[model samples]
Structures are given as C-alpha cells and as structure tokens.
Target: MAEQDWDSQTVIRKRGNVARVARTDSEINSARRAGVSIETQRKVTGNKADPGVHYQRIAKVDYADDVVPPPKLNNSVPQAIQSARQAKQMTQKELAQKINEKPTVIGEYETGKAIPNPKILGKLERALGVKLRGKDIGKPLFAKKDGK
Candidate 1:
C-alpha cells in the first residue's frame, strides 16, 4: 500500500473522536487511562485556537419538564440499550461474544419484552464500558417530593 500524507490524512480516534495524527492502539489505551472522556477539556496537540482540539464535556445535564418518560421512547428498554451499545462501539454479535452468549441472544436482548437480568446487565456494563443504572439514559428525571 502507498503511504498517505500525514497532513492530508484525518486520523479519526476511536471511542471518542478526539483528533490525533497516526494514533495507535497503545495511544488510545493511554488516553483512556488518562481519563480522556468528553468531561474535561483536554488538548490533543495543544492548539488553543482549535475548537475541535479543546473539547469539553457537560457535567450537569438539564431535564426538561415536558420530556416524556422512557416508555414513550422508541420501544423502551431495548432502545436505550441499543443506543448505549452503539455509543460504546459494540455490535450485538460482539457484545454477545463478550457475554459468552450467542448473537441471537443479543438480538432478543435488544428487542425482547423480558426485563434484563443481572447477568445480562453485567455483560452490558462490560460491553458498553458504562454504568447501566441510575440516570443512565432514556429515562426522565422525576420531580422531587415536597415533603408535605
């Protein structure tokens, strides 16, 4: 294969698309070890002028009052599961392989009406590399009690 010019090549980083030229798997691992999520503003090449270079994550998320609950979103649990899976770069087959299950199980998992068990949750956490509990996603933030 012919060598591509470094300047012309747009090296897309995996996991989170942070810009880095000719990044290896080691670099990606190192970056992850350094906690390079979308949370803190970290420079890739130390170019302050570049918005794409110094991107930051939002800490506090706002919950809109008008927002509908999860049951209203897509088909429910599976949709959230599906979205989170995609965000973590996991295909159903890949996730299934990690959980030591067949690909068909994963398909059922993403579309079935059955509530996910702890074993399945464990697989999901490992596969997506994120927590599945709490304000995980796709659920509305409920109003607090007034303590009347």
Candidate 2:
C-alpha cells in the first residue's frame, strides 16, 4: 500500500496501520477557555466522548495563616537532649530503648553529630518530658499590603 501525505489540514487520515486526526481552532480555543493548557488538553480530551464538557477550575488558596510553622532545630538540641536525659537519670541505652531507636543514634543526637527528624524528635520529647522543639514566637517580618 502507498503511504498517504500528512499535513496540518488533514483531519482524519490513515497512513498504513496508523491514523491521525487534526484539531480545529475552535476546539483549541474551547480547551483554553476551560482553563486547560494545550498539552494537558490533548490527554484529557483524548478519550472523552464529548470534549466540550466544561471543567471547573480549582481556586488557589494561601495557607500561610492556616498552618503553624514547623519548629526550628538549632545547635542547642544536643545540649537540651543531654541535660534532659541526665535529669531523668536515664542511660543512653535506656533512653534509646524507650524511643525504639539504637543507642548509637541517641549518642549521635546528644553529641550534635546527627539531627533527628520530627518523628524522632517527638519521641525524644516524650521520653525526656522536655521540649526539644522550639516554640513558634514573634510576628512575621513582612507586612501584607492592601490593594491600592
């Protein structure tokens, strides 16, 4: 079989075992007005029975006021951990066992050679009955501007 010539104007053409369909300008415009990018529109509308079905655009939200900032870790973590453990009269091995962590991990955290993630830090806080994580204090440095 002879191969068919393909061009932008070709809407439904078969070339050997493969077929192609070109998109109309109105279809492209409809996709754009629906808030779908050109690239994504191809995939979304590829298998749809009616591509004209409108898609509601999701509104973007600012979460700065909704969520609390995570606690900041500092050099004092090592000292804090060590002091709390000593105050409780708990050995490194004992503290590690309580937190289900290795003794060497506890040692490293106390020596300031390693930092614990939030989960591990929470465990340490619970075990030592001390707040290793810093509290969120003070206002943000920048002020929000009102629309002029």
On lDDT, the candidate that comes out on top is 2
Among these predictions, the greatest TM-score belongs to 2
Q: TM per model?
A: 0.36, 0.43
* For model 2, the run of ten residues with the poorest summed lDDT: 54-63
Q: Stretches of candidate 2 above 4 Å error?
A: 1-73, 136-148
- The clash count of every prediction, one per candidate, is 0, 0
RMSD (Å) of each candidate, 1 decimal? 26.1, 20.2
| lDDT assessment of candidate 2 | 0.70
Model 2 lDDT at residue 97: 97
Model 1 per-residue lDDT tens digits across residues 7-119:
77665865885566425678767778888652344445444676573333321222344567433222555776787778768888888888898887778767854455768
Candidate 1: which pairs clash? none
